[model samples]
Target: MIRGIRGATTVTSNEEEEILEVTEELVNEIIAQNSFLPDEVAQVLITVTEDLSATFPAKALRRFEDWTYVPVMCATEIPVPGSLEKCIRILLTVNTTAAQNEINHIYMREAIKLRPDLSSTKRLAQ
Candidate 1:
């Protein structure tokens, strides 16, 4: 079965370096927490707030040696009023036998407010 793991993180600035760094961290945490291999990942969809135009978050995924063949796409998030800023979100669809409740969805930094209930599970490295 295919399962989706969701995660989101925020950067202080819209700089390319910040965006890349935090995005990589977010993806790594999702991989680690869920204990999944890169080959199992079917697709990764990344989105950034309208204010963040410095770079494509998907670029960071390529930095992973084993993720070269994984499909990744980036897009802009819907700009709803009062939405979080400088946030990068990812939905990783993977081929896994794990049940939905077994999956860990990570929310870090200010993005934690997006999913307070799950934020209590663990936290992202600062």
Candidate 2:
């Protein structure tokens, strides 16, 4: 069956390095949490808030060796008046046997406020 995993993270700055660093961290966490195999991933879609334009989050994902075979796309998130800033969100489409409720969705850094219920940042360290 096909499943979609959602994840989000925030960066401190619009610099290319900062954006890439946070993005990589977020991606790694998503993979580890979901136990996702590279081959199992159908596609990855990334969206960044308008405040972050230093680079496309998808560009940073290409630097990973395991992601070379995975197709990734990027877009600008719809800017809502009160939305969080410097946020990068991703949706991964994967083929897996796990049910929807069993899937892990990650939210990290300041983005945690966006979804306190699903945010695992504080829980992991504890």
Candidate 3:
């Protein structure tokens, strides 16, 4: 089965360092929580809010040793009115035997407010 794990996080600023740092942290938590390997990831779609333009969030995946072959794409999020700023969202598709409900969707930092209904959104200790 193919499962899509949703995750999002916010950066304090639009700096490249902050963007990369938060992106890595978000993806790392998703991988850890789901217990998945990079080879199992079919693709990763990343989107950043209009307020963030320092760098492509996808670049952060390169820092992962085994993620070299994983396909990733990055885009700009739609600038809806009153939308979150300096935010990065990811839709990570992976091949897994686990059911959809078993998948963990992580929302970290200020992005936790984006999906309060998902129990997975409960903030994990930093």
Q: Model 1: runs farther than 4 Å from truth? A: 120-126
Error of 3 at 30 (Å): 0.2
Q: Per-residue lDDT for 1-126 in model 2, tens only?
A: 999999899988899999998889998988888887889999999999999999888887887777788999999999999999999999999999999888888999998998888887654764
Candidate 3 pairs with clashing backbones: none
C-alpha lDDT (0 to 100) for residue 123 of candidate 3:
36
Residues 57-94 of candidate 3 have per-residue lDDT tens digits of: 99999999989999999999999999998889999999
TM-score of each: 0.94, 0.93, 0.94
| Candidate lDDT values, in order | 0.90, 0.89, 0.90
Write down the worst ten-residue block by lDDT for model 1. 117-126
For residues 1-126, what per-residue lDDT tens digits would candidate 1 score against the true structure? 999999999999989999999999998888888998999999999999999999998999989989989999999999999999999999999999899998889998899999987762454432
lDDT of 1 at 110: 92
Better lDDT candidate (1, 2): 1
Model 2, CA-based lDDT: 0.89
Off by over 4 Å in 3: 119-126
Per-prediction tally of clashes: 0, 0, 0
Q: Name the better of 2 and 3 by TM-score.
A: 3
